[model samples]
Target: MEQPPVTPRSALHTRPKSQGCFLVGKSLKPVVAPIYKKNGIFYAEIFLNWSHIVGERYSRLCRPVRITGDKPNATLYVGASRAVAAEMFYSVPTLLERIHHYFGFQILESMRFVNDFSSPHMASTFSPKKEEAAPQNSEEADASWKGDDITYPPLREALMRFQSYMRKIK
Candidate 1:
């Protein structure tokens, strides 16, 4: 038996100056467009921005399932329950208008309610969330204080109150 000379792994595989694969100056859009068309999710922005498009009320209860057809005649299918579908029936026009307004053009011609589609928050009705107002005390004054980190909760509260008072006097 005879053994051949061994070469370093790095030396065996040399890096090429120009690496070309498949082709250059070619686009993959043609390949991906068919997949998107077949999946019925061509307009991903509609689904991703459903919350902004439909507003808080419907955004929680409804979701964009798929968009069918081409521009000027495209249909948007939304997932909702039977009750939600009925509740949303009258507001379809309003929602469609909002969707169109969101995109700045009429990408969707109509919206169809899909009862077959289901989601976890279908039956939930949520009240508009209230934002808590910031404290009246000056934030700059608090930031201006060069105090060590206080481990005690009560001491921190008292220190915050003292800072508030000092800021008021100044």
Candidate 2:
């Protein structure tokens, strides 16, 4: 009788354990990518990963409070003090770009900063040694246009910071 011919194993067969091939993070990328972000773990709040997006240095001063708008044209709202907001002024462009890259799509259109120094945490992690005098010029704000009126105090402060940011950018 003629010897039977043997066929090679097909892809449908299980891979051998000795092949040095096993499930790795890359293999599960599609399954795990949605959980991990550039700055931190992904929770329900996408902005919670702000620290990862901006960088350690910038994140220490401020944090992303929330994001608003439609899918592709969203805006990020950041919370920080006037000084920190001004410091992060020039970084907006690069930070925005980084944010866009973080989501892996063009979701955020811009950033709206909120100058919130009411809590000591906004300035830094530790409390101040003594009472610090607030700036006198904090009350000054530019004349509002027809649609630019701000009735809220915090909003006014944020607007002033935004103006200062623009000035520094220029």
Candidate 3:
């Protein structure tokens, strides 16, 4: 009788467990935004530029930014120059009143003015690029619209909303 050869166990059959790998050091608190928006308005919990200055000047100053809303929250982020920020800080309350008169709701809760030195990335990201001029006629616009169906929901909604608003005012 010939002796049978023994087979070795395959290393591919064994694998490491990864069940709790994602849960490590997880926090329960909602991370407050450096900025946020609700109901077509924008809010910021912290002014990073201001915070940096305060942190530099005083060792013991501590403050958490607060935002309040009752319903239908929407948040937006806009990057502006230091001059615009200063204007916003000084004029936002009066501006809000005018906005409410026109829109029938308060859109912005509060704003924080930040110095231009703080966030260069924001200004760069939103800066518009020079592009070929868009077609002027409806046919061109329709053709552009029909070329891609999957990615146009937001654009379509905005156009529809504008159209509706225009019709309502007319």
Candidate 4:
């Protein structure tokens, strides 16, 4: 019988449990750093919290597409409609300040406003989805009757709060 030469794969497979390797969150930095750096994004968290970075008023009117350039003063590409493009341009200075404040540093120096007519229009009126009301249990029904007897506003409020809390747990 001949002994086989140890290969990298075989070595890795035969490695002892104590010597095994595992990748942590920091290990992924090398792979993820290039993507953000290429797009000039300082942090991925900003994209997830986009609405907060840009105030509620401007959140729908415009959206940040991407950041360009490696400088601290990178160009922020914004998608908007022709109707608001001029208005948005005039507010660029204020917008820049807001963005800087958001990141706690100067991440953008200028805005490249792109008029995108095809982009979906944001509705002027917002109607949030109504949460389904929980069914009334016997305990809640009994509590309601007791609450009705008490005309004291403070006591009634406390009862209502208790009922709501019970409903959530149930």
Specify the poorest-scoring 10-residue window by lDDT in model 3.
Answer: 56-65
User: Tens digits of per-residue lDDT for model 3 on 3-64?
Assistant: 88766577557777768757432552233322233222222322343334234322122222
Which parts of model 1 are misplaced by more than 4 Å? 1-42, 123-170
RMSD of 2: 21.5
Q: How high is each candidate's TM-score?
A: 0.50, 0.45, 0.24, 0.50
Model 1 clash pairs? none
lDDT, candidate 3, at 114 = 36
Measured with C-alpha atoms, the lDDT of residue 74 in candidate 4 is 72
lDDT of 1 at 91: 93
lDDT per residue as tens, model 2, 91-160 = 8888878877886766677887897764335545445688765545533322332225678888878877
Tell me the whole-model lDDT of each prediction, alpha carbons only: 0.76, 0.67, 0.45, 0.73
Candidate 1: tens digits of C-alpha lDDT, residues 1-170 = 98998899998798766755655325767776776775444377777778877899888777888778887698988888888788998998999899888878777888888874455474344435689665567675467564567878888889888887887898
lDDT winner between 1 and 4, please give it. Answer: 1
In model 4, state the lDDT of residue 145: 55
Report residue 142 deviation for candidate 1 (angstroms): 68
Clashes of each: 0, 1, 8, 0
* lDDT, residue 20, candidate 4: 64
